[model samples]
Target chain A: MQPVLQWENVSFAYDGRFEINALSYVIEQGDFTLFFGPNGAGKTTLFKLAVGLLKPAIGRVVLGERPLSEWKTLEIAKYVAYLEQEAQYIFPFTVEEIVLMGRFPHTASQFWDRKEDLEVVAWAMEITGILRFAKRSIFQLSSGERRKVEIARALCQKPKILLLDEPTNFLDVRQQVELFETLERLNREERITIGVISHQLSLAKNFVKSAIFIQGGSVGSAGPPEAMLTPEKMSEFFGLNVSKVSVL
Target chain B: MNIMNASNSNVIARSPEGTTKQSQIQRLLRPQLGSRLAMTTGISPGKLVLIIVFFVAILFVTFLVSLLSGAAHVEWGTSEGQFILMQLRLPRTLLAFLVGMALSLAGAVFQALLRNPLADPHLLGVSAGGALGVVVGSGFLIAGSFVLAIPVLSLLGSLAAVMVVYRFSLRKGALSLYTLLLIGVVMNSLFISVIVLVQSLVRSDELTTVLFWLLGNLSFASYPRLFAISVIIFTAAWFLLRQARKLNILSFGESTAHSLGVPIERTKKIIFLVASLLTGIAVSMSGMIGFVGLIVPHLARLLFGSDYRKLLPTSAVLGGIVLILSDSLARVIVIPQELPVGVVTAFLGAPFFIYLLKRQEAKRVI
Candidate 1:
């Protein structure tokens, strides 16, 4: 199968400081991948490039066999969804309405949601376990619930590739595992490609099938969990000790 | 476990109705009436009728009170009273109502687009821009006949101001709230200073006229000119209400809107221009009336909820009510010497604004 996304010698800079330098990676179709890095290690920058929110300074970022710049913004949105970390909203939109906004790219009119849009929204909310809170104010929900709502919103867009930045930030241990399990279910059943930016190094090995370890604006390694997350490699990338805990 | 296994097919495959569990719409059980109404559709037909009836009843009473209680005393039965009602008070009240509607609707939309309840024409420097245009281009209206020239120049000025402020405030195509407000304050002062300098340069005979223009009032609008201003204000307001969904989408956050395929930069520019045009119309018609936008929009949100489709028109009506009441208060407060309507609005609006800011600050501290 063709790679769903590729970055070929991509380099990006902000205020003369390079964020992503000469980075190359190929994410195959149906891959549940972790984009693991320390803070400011260009994980978010790469995600922005993949979603066409930002353009690279040097090389091309490719999505589905075409250059990122070739697609219209709405067209790219239809194919890829990017959820920012801590998606804060101003208005008191109810859960259903917030989820329905994800279908904005699919409809002809910006205002009206069609039947299919409503159905998709219902399903998205249902899957995310927020169908019960459809009428409740999003502001009233806890951070973990709000994060779930955000995930439901991204799901309603019907994206082929869902790129989330800091998906596990506010989630507790159980919620974090549940989130990954949910995404894993979606990845297995729907074939939606997942590229999540996460700093939770220990959890990525248990939940994700593969990970891309990035350090100093370059991909240090890319492979399955056991191969890429060895203790020495973990120490090298994160400067931390890792020991296996054996269960009796 | 059951939900996890059953939903595993992943084509969004389960039929909404056939499923044993209730769909979201059916499961909605919010306690508040407005929220419950908001849950079903943007505006329920029954509630819309209720809103219309309430607004019409209140509007009729306010209109009657405004027409009958002006300083020029004539019995309601007399021809003299009829003349005042038809000629003087009627037009003034209508202009007040129209200006109020324009400013409030603009405020409502601006608040939505900027995602800040504090967004207003006066605070955003739009009114100062319009005032600048009037001060510098004094005879643009040609011997004070209430033509379209003033509104046109004012619109141009307001749009320019918004553009300048927007460009300065933009950080990566989004307006940060602090930066935008700070620049707006600086630009307002800058533009007002220019207006003062222009007033000094003008012939001494025109100084009172400039002063009257600076201190907003509603007494000068003729019926014919009121008709023209009405068309412009309503047409612009209608155009804005038509984009209600876009405003709703925008209020969430620019990135969310963008991720949902909204062209962020273009939407921002269009909304900014329309909102500025409304401010210019309000300014040109009746100098810089403060707080109609600030007060009326929050009132509308209280009644109509946050959905812009319902909120915009409701704000327009409530805005009219507030301004008509304020203008009437300006007329009858001291019994003879009429207050500048803008002064009354500021007096009413500033306290409420400070209160809102205080509440916002308290919330942050909490």
Candidate 2:
């Protein structure tokens, strides 16, 4: 498979401090990759760079062999869907309405949702298991349900590559597994590239095909999960004894 | 289909086609609450039509009532009555309606732009800026005789306020809503102080005029002035309606909006400029009328949904209705001695604001 997202010698800094330094990684089509590191190791920042929320100070971010800077925001959004760590909405938009917003990149210039857009939203909601609560207010739902609504929204984007930042952050263990399983299905069945930044190392190891361990704003190692997430590598990257890392 | 099999554990017999069929049947069985059309426009065309018609009729009735009942009852057939209706009452009522429409639309826009329910045109220092402009602009003129200069100067003042508030609140390339709100509070207090200082320096003979104007009066509106202001208000209203979808997306917060391909910075700037123009022009036309902007949009949101497409127009019409009714009450409430319409609005609006806060507090518990 061809590379769907490539970060070539990418570097980024915030307020005179480096958050990412000369990092290079490639996520090929239909690849399910997990990025994990200690807090503030710039996993989230790497996602930001991939989505062009932040521009790399050095080198380039490329999608489909084209430089990211050459694409408009709408075009980039169509190709890659980015889900932030938190979901915030000020108004009482319905679950369906919020998910329908995922079709925005496609229907931005239109005054209203088209028939095809509605169908896609319905299909998206169905896959994400949120069709039952389609008419309910997002604020009324539990946190796990809300996360599904967010995933449903991302699915509606019909993206080639999906980047989720801590999709399982607030979820219980069961919910986290269910979310990852759904994501794995998308990666396999829909053939969409998936990159996720997560802390659930032991849990995520079951779903992800490959792993990229980040340390001190750089890629410490990347390979198949079995090799890359060994106890030796975990201790080195997280600065903890393998026995103390219970989550792993 | 495979994902559904792997993850969905519910006993409900379902397939992709089954879900589609169920939704189709549900759509048929469901009572139409205008939601079919609301799917795209936020409000159904039929409901919007009915609402517009109902409000238009109410607005017409209020116009006639205000035209005939104020202090002096004027017969429709008599020439003297015709003179009072056409010359004095008609312009006043129309101006009130226009000002109401402008303020309410501006308020709705501000609330959405700031993502705060409490946001209003007056809260952002635009009205205060206009008031300061009027006080200072009129000071340079031969006190009570300058009609045109008041509006010109007030518009300039408000635009300047918009510039300052917008400039200072911007960070790098994006707007910081937190900073924007704080700067608005600061600018309002600072501008109000300048207005009071200007008020102190005025001649005693001119003091009452400035004070009455400051308290908000619609008696100064004439046919020519109304005609000029109406063009601007309508144009701005049309522009706002076109921006409904962007505003809807913006309610999700700037970062999400950006990820969804919305140029949040550009949208915010355009909305800010247009909303400020509406507020500035309303203030210039009729001194500083408070509460109409704050109260009308909230009432509209309650009556209608929060969709900007529906909310903006509804707020405009409802605003016109509220202001017309309030102006009429101000005319006849005490007979022969007119109360400033602003006082009546504040009197009505403050209680409602308190009620809203109480309701919100109650909602938070849930």
Candidate 3:
């Protein structure tokens, strides 16, 4: 099967400064991958490039066999949904309304939300455990709940691939596990490819099928978590002594 | 751990309790219903229609009151009263309503586009641009009525001024809110200085009309003139509301909206032009009424939340109601010699603006 996304010798610059240089990775269909790195490792930048929000200065990213740059944005949005690390709002919109925004690419007409749109939104919220808070103001939501709402919104997009950045930031330990478990189920049942940028290696290691260690704006290594994240490799890449332990 | 997860799942499974399809009367009778209902299901199509009806009803009441309470007391039963109502009060009231609709709706769009609550055409240099254009076009006025020339000139000026400020504010072809606002102020000052310099050169007779217009009010509304602007205002407002969902996405943030397939640059430009057009039209009709554009949209968001589909119409209605009431107060407060409606709205709106500013500061602190 074709890879869901492919990047070859990709480089990106911000303000004419090269932040990412000669990076490449491939995300396969229905694969769960974690992009692991320290702060400023360019994981967020990689995600943006993958989703076509940012363009590579040197090379190209292909989504579903087509270069991302060639696809129309709305068409690309239908295939890949992205969730931000932190969400902010200037207006007091409801949780339901925020979730419904995921159906934006699927909107059938001008300013109209079809019944199917509502149904998908409701299902996404329900799965994310935010359905009951559907009527509550997003402002009134706790940070953890707000993160779930963001996840629900991404899910509402019903994309083939999901990209989440720091999605577990505000979630509790159990919610963290549940979120990964949910993503695992989506990968298994819906065949939705998932890419997560995360800090909690301990929580995500079991759920992710593959892991990439990003350092100095390039992929240090990419493979199964056990194969690529050895203690020696981690210690060398992080410039700190590291150890690995089996918790279960 | 699994058991606790199960329990938390159970907690989340709780159904939406005791809130659905709240009636308008019920909302009035039960104050908490406002927050409860506004937050849920957003607003249904039927509910939006009902809200529109409710505002239209309020508009009608205000219209009657405004017609009845003007400087001269004329009985509605008599021919003289009918003439007064038709000739003076009716046109003024309609003009006020249209201006209110245009300004407030534009305000809602501007706030969403700029993602700043304080954004308004008056504050962002669009209205000043319109006023500058009006001053330049002051030579063409026929007995205090602009007919249509001022609106056309003013629309181009408003669009130009905003584009200039917007271009200056761009950091790599994207707007920085702070810079946009800063340049807007500078542009406004420049436009005002130019207006003053031009005013010094024009005839004293033309100067009086320009001065009254700069303050902004409905005192100069005429029937044919009001009708012409109304066509533009309503059409522009309809176009805006059709783009409601796009506006909603844009308000979340530019990058976020872009991820969801919003053509960010195009949408922003469209909103900027639409908002500027509306501002130009309103200013040409009623001059630069400062607070309506700044406050009415915020008021709509407060009352109806920020779903632009609902917020836009709600702001339009509430704006009309607020302006009609303000104009009525303007007419009656000083008796025979009416105060400009702008004065009345500013007196009412400035404190509210400050309160919102303080609240925003408090939010930042927290």
Candidate 4:
């Protein structure tokens, strides 16, 4: 099968002064890819490009052999679910209600959340272990719980690929482990492609099969996690001393 | 078996924490009776029916009172009474209903679109625009032709104000709610100043008419004027109701709504245009009736929750009822002489609005 997503020499910028240089990457079907970077490394920008929220200034971002721009937003939504760094729920939507929004791209307008939609929502909630809080207002949930609810929402889309930005942020240690384990289970059992952006190298090391390191709006290194997450690359990309601390 | 026992004891030891967890779970799972009843068969339907019934009842009583209790003491069963009822009181009551619905609906839409709790029909400069139009139409152009100038000038003024505010608020194909509101405040002040300046220049004879217009008297609204306002308000309400879903999504913020495939630019333009039209027509007919628009939507939301599907329609109906009653009260409170409908709405709506605000604050605190 063709790669699920491909970025060929993609470049972007918020303004003319600061720009993301041309960078090429590909995420294949069932691949668990982690993108790690220092602050201002364009990781979020890359995710935005993949989801077609932002257009590439140079070259192209292709999903399923179609240019990102060419794909209808609703159609692209069916194939890829993107979780932004900050997910804001401004209204008082229940967890189930929010999860049901993921199915909006597929469901008919009058049939907002029919039986099949509810089944999918329930299953997604089950997998994410947020079924207990399904009826609770999203605003009432803690940040970590809300994150799981969001993940459940994305999972409800049943997308071929999941793009998550800082999924582990604000999570407790046990919650972090649970989240990573859930992602691993989804990737292995469902064979879902996953692309994640994170600053925590050790956490990324455990979860991702392939890794990419971004620095100064450019790719510093890209390959298997073991090879890309070296001391030299870490020190160079992050501008920090790299010394491994033993975890007992 | 021993390991199971050990863990079971551990679980038992943590019983209090587990109970608290369970209690929280129970609290979340338990359907809120108030909201459920409110959603299913609560205040909305009840209020709607009551409002309708009360409006009709009050309208009938007010019509009778307006005819019989006036200086002439017209008998209800006589031809003079019937003529006064059909010609004068009926038109005024209908005008009051239309004006109230228009103002409240405009206020609701503005508050939702701007995401500001304080937005009202007059606060956004549309009322000021209508006032300015009335002043210019009566004072300069028509020279005391209040009937001819009322609709035309009000519409022109409201449309002008809306366009100015919209243009000022737009930045990169997006409108900032805060900016729009600030611009509205500034434009309202400016428009009011211009109205005042015109009032200062006009002869004393025209000043009384201007004051009456400013204070929002429905005494001059004839059958023809009521028909015109009815047509405009109904048309505007239909357009707004059709866009209710888009408005619901808009409450989620612009970027999020866009991601969900809502054509943000198109939706915003339609809402702004329709809301302004509604406000303009209402203000032109009734002058600046203050609190009905600002308070009615919030009350609807509080009673029915923030689902615009229910909120918008409920607000329109309730608004009509509120205004009709207020208008009736305005006519009856002091016999012979009458109070402006605006005065009645403000006196009633402001206290209810403050009560709602306090209730919402208390809910938040809890």
Candidate 5:
């Protein structure tokens, strides 16, 4: 089978200043790919392109052998779910209502949420351990809890691929561990393709199968995490000291 | 390894309990039958019941007061009283109700679409459009024919103003709420100036009619005009209610609505068109009744939640009742001479509006 996601020589720019040069990468089925870069390295922009939210200035984004432009957004939504970094709740919707919105593409009409839709939402919530907060207003939830609810909403779509942008940001240490563990379990058990953009190298090293290091809007290295994430490469790309120390 | 197995077994054993607890919680969280019934029509049962009872009571009292307490001071159930009630009070009451429903419903839709608590039909240039039309129509008014010219010109003017605002405010196929509001304010000011210029140019005799119309009197409301306005208001209300779900999604913000497959452009167009029509019709029927639209929707939101399903219908019904009571008081307050219904609405609604604002601030602070 073709790679679950492919970015071929993609280029993007915003307002003519910050630009992402020609970039190419492939994410195989069931791969936990971590995209590592500093702030403004076009991490969010790349995710946006992958999810078809933004069109590349050059080249193309392909999913399951189909070009991003060719697939209807609702159809694409069935295969890929995007969790934005900011989990802002603009309306006073309950947690259940927000989760049910994930099933909107599958809903027959705007008026009703069917039994199957509720069941899927319930399952997603259960997996995220947010089933107990179903009736709580999203605005009332803590940042970590709201992020979990957002992930639950993405999972409710039953997408084959998940794209997350800084999912660990604003989360407590325990919450971060819980989220990473959840992602690991989902990837291993469900065989879901996952792409995450993160600055946390330690967490990324533990979870991701591969790494793509981006610097100055261009790929620095793309290979197996163990081989690509060396001390010298880390120092060169991030301009930081790299040292390993025993925990105990 | 033994401890891991034991913990794993504990997790498996606790699964049924968790499921049972969730089901129980779900049952408790489910809305009651009364709430469900309320939700079906897009308003809470408690508010609906209160509105229905208030409407009936207000209607009866206003009708009785309007007939008995006018300049004629006609006794209840007498021949003169019956004639006044049938000929004047009844039509005025119907006009008040229709205008109130139209303005309030329009206001609710405006607030939802703009996502601003301060939005109202009058604030968005529709009232000024109607006022300009009425002022222009006054120039063509023949003796005893002011009624025909007023509604026709008012409706035309309102439609024209709305079209101008909408055309100018749209950018890249989307209406920017801020631009729309700014254009509305400017257009309204320009239209008001034109109305003033027209009022100055009219003959002294026509000036009284124009001034009364501008002040928004329902004293001239006939049975036929009342019937026409009633039909228009009810039709507009039904159209808005049908689009309630779209409004609900819209309140969540445009991008989210679009992602959920709601055609944002089409929905906005339909809402703006229908809401403008309702405002125009209301303004044409009763000259520039302010604050009913501005205040009633907020009141409804406070009484019920911000859910449009409940918000729209409740606003409409409560709006009608508020106008009826206001109109009745307008007629009876001075006894010999009546006050303008617009003045009454502003007088009553402004205080209620302030109270609501303070309450909202208090809620936010807490």
Candidate 6:
């Protein structure tokens, strides 16, 4: 499969601190990839670079074959949808309303949402199991429901590749299982490329096909999950004893 | 559980009465095209349109009621009474409505643009700058056109303040909210000090007019002044309305808005300038009406959901209603001794605002 997203010699730093230097990686089409790393490992930064939210100081991030700099931000949004970790808001927009916002890149010029836009939004909500609460205020939903709402929103964008930063962060075990199951179905059935930043080592191993291990600021390893997430590798990178952890 | 029920049989469609007996899969596959705004807000477009029209009708009725009732009793049968109705009360009433609309709309836009719930028109210090312009401009001859000089000078002053804030608060191409608000507070005090210095320098006779204007008096509103302010205010409002969707996305936060393809800095700057223009015109016309700009948007948000598309128009109409009623009360409450409308708004808005906050809390909507 062709690489859907590629970062070549990418380097970025915030105020000359917290740097990611000479980091190169690729997310191929139809790949269910896990961005596995510890805290402050620059996984989120790499996701931002992939979505073109932040430009690299040294090198280029390419979407398909074109450099991200060549694509307009709005045009980039059409192909790559991003969901930041912890989507917080003070407003009381309904679930459907929040989901419908995903179509903004397509519907920005129109005065109102067209029929197809509404259909896509409905379909997204349905698949994400948020259809019933479509008219409910997002503020009223639990964290799991809210995550599903946001996922429905990203799905509504009909993006070729969806990038989520720590989507399972606040979800419980059952909800986590449900979320992973849904993601697995989407990857296998819809064939949308997926890149998730996660620390749920055992649970994510079941859903992810390929795992990209990031340590410090660069890729420590990248391959199938079984090879990459070995006991020795987990102990080495995450500093966690493999025997102490209990799996559900 | 709710999702299961929805996907099973009771597929929610356009309206309750119109839910066709279609499978959930088919329904999701081809949803009907209806009012998109209604689809989001759960209020149909026709009903939403009617709600806006009803509020406007209420505003017109309040306008007529205000025109008829004031401190001076007028006999409808007499030509003198008709003259007072047509000339003085009409213009003042209309000015109050327009100023209210300008302030409220500006407040709503400012809140959205700053992404701060507490942001108001005066938070930018534009009003203080306008006050300074009125005080200093009053002293100039300006080809003996004192009337034209005041509004123009105030407009220039507010724009100057905006330019200074815009220039200083921008850090590395993006506007910093903390810096913008900090500069605003500093400029407000700075302008107030200059106004006091100018006030001491002016003759005693001119001092009273400037002081009364500062306290928010509408006694001098005339037809020409009213016409000019209305034109500018309506145009600015239309411009802000065009930015409603982008403003809605902006409420999601700056990064999210940018990711969704909103030109963040450009949108922020354009909204800032236009909203400042509204504030400048409002201050130039009505002096510093304290609570209308700050509290009226909150009231509108409570009444209409936090959607800017609805909030903008609702705030305008509700602002008009609140100010018109307050101005009428200001005229008659003291019986020939007029309290400044600004004083009444604070007195009225505070209690009513608290009451609404309590209700929202009870509903758990906030």
TM-score of chain B of each: 0.79, 0.87, 0.81, 0.81, 0.84, 0.87
What CAPRI class is candidate 4?
A: incorrect
lDDT of 3 by residue, B25-129 (tens): 222323232223233454467777888787778777888898887789798689998888998888888888888989999888888887887688677788888
Best by lDDT: 2
DockQ of each: 0.40, 0.41, 0.37, 0.17, 0.22, 0.44
The segments of candidate 5 whose C-alpha lies over 4 angstroms from its true place after superposition are: A1-91, A97-103, A108-126, A130-139, A152-235, A238-248, B1-79, B136-144, B193-220, B226-232
- lDDT by residue for model 6 over A1-248, one digit each (tens)? 89989999999989886567899988889999999887898999998888777889998999988999998877887888888999777667788878888888887775555667776777787667676677788778988898899888888778889888998988999999988888887888778999999888789998899999888779988999888777877777777776896431
| lDDT-better candidate, 1 vs 4 | 1
lDDT per residue, candidate 4, B1-366, as tens digits?
A: 444443443333334423566546433432331122123221234555765675567556654544444444667779987887778777876787788788888888887687666778788798898888877767565444656667688889888899899999988777767788899999999999998898778766556776776787777778777777788789888878767656765666665455554556777778977888888888777778889998888877766556565677778877876787777778778877788888888888888888877875665511
Candidate 5 lDDT, B1-366, residue by residue in tens: 444443443343335433666545544433331132123222235655786787677667655665555667667779987887788777877778788889999998988788776788888898899888777766666757876778888889998899999999998777877788899989999999887887677656766776787777777788888878778778878878777767866765665455444556788888988999999988888888889999998888777656676678878878887887888888778877889888999888889888888875665510
Where does model 4 exceed 4 Å of error?
A87-93, A107-138, A152-158, A167-192, A229-232, A244-248, B1-74, B172-179, B200-203
What clash count does candidate 2 reach?
Answer: 0
User: Residue A87 lDDT in model 4?
Assistant: 70
Query: DockQ for the candidate 6 complex?
Result: 0.44
Candidate order (DockQ): 6, 2, 1, 3, 5, 4
* Model 3: per-residue Cα lDDT at residue A40: 85
Q: Candidates' lDDT values, in order?
A: 0.77, 0.82, 0.80, 0.73, 0.76, 0.81
Comparing 3 with 4 on lDDT, the higher-scoring candidate is: 3
lDDT, residue B155, model 5: 89
Estimate, for each residue in A63-156, the C-alpha lDDT of model 3 and write its tens digit. 9989998998788888998887887888878888899898888782556555556767756766676767777777777777888888788887
| lDDT, residue A115, model 3 | 58
> Which pairs clash (backbone N, Cα, C closer than 3 Å) in model 4?
none
| Count of backbone collisions in candidate 4 | 0
* TM-score for each of the candidates: 0.85, 0.90, 0.87, 0.80, 0.77, 0.91
lDDT of 2 by residue, A1-248 (tens): 79989999998989999999999989998899999888899998998888788889998999898999998888887889888887776666678778878888888877645656776776677677776677777768877888889888888788999999998988888899889988998999788899999988888998999999888789988999998777887777766787866546
